[model samples]
Target chain A: MIFAVMVALLVTMVLALVRAFMGPGLYNRILAINTFGTKTVLFVAVAGFLFGRPEFLDIGILYALVNFVATVAVLRLTHLQDPWSGTEGGEAG
Target chain B: MSLLDHDPTGVASAQNRRRKSTVRLLRTAPLPAVFWLLLSGRYEPLTLALGTLSVAAVCWLTWRAGLAHQSLRLAFVLRLPRYFLWLSGQVLVSAYGVARKVWSPRLVLRPVVESTPAADLPELSQVVYANSITLTPGTLSLDVDEDAIKVHSLEQAGVEELRQGRMLSRARRTEARG
Candidate 1:
């Protein structure tokens, strides 16, 4: 069961990467990477159970934190560097 | 070095500073200590002692950096588990949503960037809300401003869900107990 979960996570990650590569713009790539990071967190947690070394869950928690921090950092940097870069113009309703 | 002489300010305020630092240390150390214990997973005296030292060092550094603005309040802490459980359920639901979109034969993405007002939320919850948006599938928080959050969503539904203000209110409620 855990193995199946891991495989599903991997497939999602691959899809995210594909989106990242075929990005329409910078925001798309960032979103893709962020989704990939999230899936990696789940992948790590499930793999820990599948491999019978649940200690990896701790690392999974750390990865989740790192993923959030990195996303915020990258977004902030890009926004500061170019206020209207790849982000869509105007607020969508 | 004397017990409290580490305070460079040579005055009565020095004692107050030392006391405040000690209090901050006590407040901040426990969370990191617990993290260290869980991550290290060894009960030996040597490992425990090392973990304690490392946590103390980290706490001291954070204190010196003036990063200890929030006091440890029990009420807010108690509300965290409920908030986390809710967030986790949201994560799972959205993850499945994204998986379905990803596996669909047609590329049914109608990406939209929307802004949600987040100024009313407590300061800490603003971050929580932003991170939660990013963690959930189909929505990525592109910019977390003081007054609003700019989010990029893979579909229009994701933007609609965020604009509904459910998750933002929940995050604010998480900190309201204190």
Candidate 2:
């Protein structure tokens, strides 16, 4: 049963990765990446249970914290770039 | 505490700064210590002491790393349980909704970027709101500035919900209670 959950999370993560690669906009890519991160946490926790080691939840929490920091960092960088400005230095491109 | 006596060596100010950091360190220590205890699954005194020492050291380092040292307000801390319960409920509901939509034949995604005024809320509450949006399924907080937050929604429903400002009011109430 736990293995089934892990499999579903992995499938969701793959779908999110596909969306990240096919982004119509930068925010779309960021959103996909964030979703992937969340799925990764769930995947790790479920996989831990499937493998008979619940201690992996601690690592899952660590991944969650890292994911949040990464999201904040990416958001700050994107905001600073302001791709809509169209100026060379200001553009995300 | 003689403020009138100005020492040329500036020892008093240094002492004051150290004391402030110490207080911040203490305020933040217990949380990480409890986390460590739970993760380590140990009741041994040596392990507990080591955890305490490490948590204190890390807290002190972060405190000195120039992060704003807002001492945790007791009122805000007390409200965390309620806020988190509400947030988790929202996350679960949206996660289910998004999952169903993703599996449906119709890929009806209507993503949009909308800005909401953030200046009216306290700094911590602003952060809480942003994180809550990001944690939910259909909404992502793309940018947060002094005046507003830019959020991207996966569909019109999420967009309308945010526009209605129920979550914003809930966040404000949390901060207000604190």
Candidate 3:
């Protein structure tokens, strides 16, 4: 079952990868990459279970933090370059 | 203090959210989990130590890299449970749609984008909405606006149905009330 879940997440990752490649705008690419990161977390967790290593949950947790940090980085980068143009205080938190 | 119930009330204070997150993060990170794995007899000698070390290394590197940080509003953090429930149902429904298309005789994909809105909601909620949409099998949040979202769906009708869905409007309301 865990293997099956990993495969499904892989499929999702592939789709997101496709979107990332075919993006119409930078936001589209970032959205796809974000999706990829999330599914990767789920994939890691399930794969860990399948391999009889529940300890691998740490990887999943780490990936979760990485995902959030990546988004914040992108958000900050966008602010630096004024790409998203979606917030206040110019560099508002 | 007991681990389960020690000063539970004190933890609820908004000021503690940061401290709570920091501790919770350290506890749950892969290093500790891998440690648990070894302590509980899951990993062999070399594998156990290596696993924990690698997890720790990544955690340390990522933290120090200091990619960037924009602290989101507390309101968004508080609403995570509700968002998780909303996302589970959305992902399931979208998965079914994707599977049906995969197994069906003729592909009926009619993907389209519909303008929707996350008006009057905390920006964090909007970010969650955008992120969650990408997980659903047949839909992606292509563009978002304070007043609207451009949802790309596998079918135009899916986009239509999404506009009428409870999750979007309720999410909007929740953020608005924040």
* Residue A41, candidate 2: alpha-carbon lDDT: 91
TM (chain A), candidate 3: 0.82
Best-matching candidate per TM-score: 2
Error of 3 at B175 (Å): 3.2
Candidate 2 true-interface contact recovery: 0.00
Which residue pairs clash within candidate 1?
none
Q: Distance (Å) between predicted and true CA of B164, model 1?
A: 3.0
Q: Write the per-residue lDDT of candidate 3 for residues B1-178, one digit (tens) a residue.
A: 0112133456466457556545544644654565557555655788778777777765555444431122333575566667788779878977987998999998777778787666655655577667777777888888887667788888886667667756676566555535
Give the per-residue lDDT of model 1 (tens digit) for B1-178: 0112244666787778767767866888888988887678789999888888899898877766555544557877888899899989999999998889878999788898988778866657877899999989789998877689999998888888888889988888888853
Instruction: Provide TM-scores for the models.
Output: 0.68, 0.71, 0.52
Where is model 2 more than 4 Å wrong at Cα?
Answer: A13-40, A62-93, B1-18
DockQ for every prediction shown: 0.10, 0.12, 0.10
Q: Candidate 2: count the clashes.
A: 0
Q: Kindly give the stretch of ten consecutive residues in candidate 1 chain B with the minimal lDDT sum.
A: B1-10
DockQ of 2: 0.12
Error of 1 at B108 (Å): 2.8
In angstroms, the error of model 3 at B14 is 24
